[model samples]
Target: MPDLFLLNISASSIFDAASPEAASIRQLTFEFIIAASAVLLLVVILTSYITVKYRSKHRHEDPKQITGNRALEIWMVSVPLALVILFLFRSLATMNAILPDRGNHTPDIIITGHQWFWEASYPGTTVTTANEIHLPTGKRILMLLNAADVIHDWWVPALGPKMDMIPGMNNYLWLTINQPGIYDGACSEFCGQQHAWMRIRVIAQLQPDYERWLSEQTTNTHIPQDTMAKAGAILFLESTCSSCHRLKGTAAAGITGPDLTHFGSRQTMLTGMMANDSGNVARWLSDPQAVKPGAHMPRFIFAKDSIRALTAYLEQLK
Candidate 1:
């Protein structure tokens, strides 16, 4: 059973990305497996020996009573104490190795976790995106995490450990992806009814690809724009959305909600609780309360045509 369990755990894909942090975790896991297996094997062998050696047959035979053996007691205590100290040192080293150093050249990305969606930004580039984050492979990313309305967590299993996104507070972590790939993660904190839907995708790409994506994201592509998106843009300007959202090169400037400047480019919307397709955006814009109860965004069902037009515009943001 122990071997089977260890095999199963080892077989799982926990070392795909090969990041520095992942390497540390892998080392610690190996130490734990070795120590735990040794302990279990000793217990099983000792128990079996005692059972067979203590078996009795004569009715008049009295079992020998043995007091505690000093040497045996000392060995047991010292062995476990040494093992525990080793584990502690390993854990501390892993923690320090994964955390970002103040002097390290860590790329800073601001992330705001909402009730069900994730918002990310590069202040220097003035680029905002949701759900998906693009990073240059093999480079460290230092994320400054926060929550706009409620608590959320940033967790990428293959990358490193999880960090909390608290309101009015700052939490940070450093991670580096070894290669280009998309990793799946979810908000580990329960913020609202849609907490289960709070998913995020981490995309690590080659440096050139990442730079190209970044340039494209920063460039405004509203040319030959659809009338719906344009009309929606206007309505969005006049509505309460402008009070919470901020869209560069537009009149919409607010920070109470997610940035919508490049919302259309994102793969998912509503904090990764829904696809970025127009239908979901329309439905959400029409009635946020119905689709996601307790959502901070109020329902705008009364403006059906206007919302449809606005959703079309927002969707064209790509």
Candidate 2:
């Protein structure tokens, strides 16, 4: 089983910086923390000392009134002003380093956000996948983001900053992964009722492994010749399943939903909300809304035998 806790955590706990871009952001964050803590401590100490030293001794007598001291005023204003300028330059330098540069030789990927799922496709190739993206390590990746319906934010804390996917517009972001591992992310924007489940998974692999995965995805879906799987395939085309989903090199060519060219090969389903297994897939097919409210997929009333056959057929898609 995958570690669910590590897959879902607050953005502030970005300690596992897997990429150089993320590490740069983490370093700046720590610098800001240290500077803010020092200022807070100084203010607290001075407040305490002044309060006790100037306490009222008698109710009738008033303390000596005096105008503000020039030295104290100058110190108060200059200290914060200097700190502000220091942080400003530091932030600008970090941004310059992390910003996307078109001069570099980077592979471009298009990412389109729907109501609750993500679709990724490689440019100049027929390789289209959903929810999960495979990337090559030690290479800069340029992502062009757009929204199909509403505004959505693509954010992977271990990669880089968040970029908004706006309708009728395109936004770009870049990241270079130094390590090979799985990084989890989600839509930072509140798109709709099921926005919380709009999750994503990025698998950083070596150059050779990434090439193999890409080749596999570009190929057609495996056509099973077994008795039950063949029947399930017939039923899938006869029913409404093909209306919203698509399977490469098959009659199902609809694009209203995620492409199911390699559904069984994926680690999770329903935008990474549940494990992609026989039991989970069957459950989701029976009632999608029960698993995720406000999901675009309607509740399918499949018979027990039909469900089993479909599950078996889908599991062989790998």
Candidate 3:
């Protein structure tokens, strides 16, 4: 494992780990810190003692010419090497224990990484959402991860292993959350220009809450009731935008971008980086390239009225 993946962390605060998997990582991190500190203290004390003991007592006399001790040489060489080996083995074992593998059985969720967004689909149901992911607590939720474009890495510091989502290949991660909370993460690998903004928000819920959320996601988006919003929905389906995004049970069946079936239910937009509000959505629709320089969504020249209507309609998706 590269040291690069070891420190991948992004969150509002240090949460009481939602899962034992995350706790194991915390344990390992503390172990690394303690081990490093002990070595540092030993080195400092030894250096200070050596300097004091060898200092010349008389003004004109030279200090004792001390030679290297065979025992000390052997101890120094063997001790560090032994410590290194022990840690190497310990980290590997911890990784195996938390990371999802064949022993984890099968994936309950299939997550695909696009240029700057995350699309998650539940295998057993018709639930697919972007950026914000939800999972039930107290269950071993296995995830099969892949990438649609360049390579990406899914890492949540509080959930344990950082797995790479490579194009044309599959990796895995599992989380058995112990409590209900909101955990945030990001695309650890640099996938593109907007890579830094490719954020991940995970909502771990109790089984009942998770079930309710899942049931909601599985439902098709309702027709807009407001006049402006209804018109906006029509425009959205007829425009070129429909060709890039997918809306469940709608004429918009494109698959090149994130799923928008449950867009209104999501708290954040632009791959979980910005708030999902009327202004943000309007700004994104009018000039996607301006807000996200490297985004694949091109600029759309919509009338101010159209922008407002569209924003209203999108906000009614939930």
Which numbered prediction scores highest in lDDT against the true structure?
2
Q: Per-prediction TM-score, please?
A: 0.84, 0.93, 0.89
Q: Write the per-residue lDDT of candidate 2 for residues 31-107, one digit (tens) a residue.
A: 99999999999999989999998777776777678878999999989999999999999999999888846565444
- Cα displacement (Å) at residue 150, model 2: 0.9
lDDT of 3 by residue, 1-318 (tens): 212321333343334455788888888888989999999999999999998987777779665788889999999899999999999999999888887366738789999999999999998899989998998989988899999999999977677667899999988787797767777788999998999888888888899999999999999877899899999999999998799998899999889999998899887888766778888899989898888998999788999999999899999899
- Candidate 3, overall lDDT? 0.85
Q: Rank the candidates by TM-score, best first.
A: 2, 3, 1
The global C-alpha lDDT for each of the candidates, from Candidate 1 onward, is: 0.77, 0.86, 0.85
TM-score of 2: 0.93
- Across 267-303, the per-residue lDDT of candidate 1 in tens digits comes to 6676556567778888888788887787778876547
Per-candidate clashes come to 3, 0, 1
lDDT of 2: 0.86
- Which residue pairs clash in candidate 1? 117-271, 229-313, 232-310
- Colliding residue pairs in candidate 2: none
* Runs with alpha carbons beyond 4 Å of true place in candidate 1: 1-13, 45-62, 104-107, 221-224
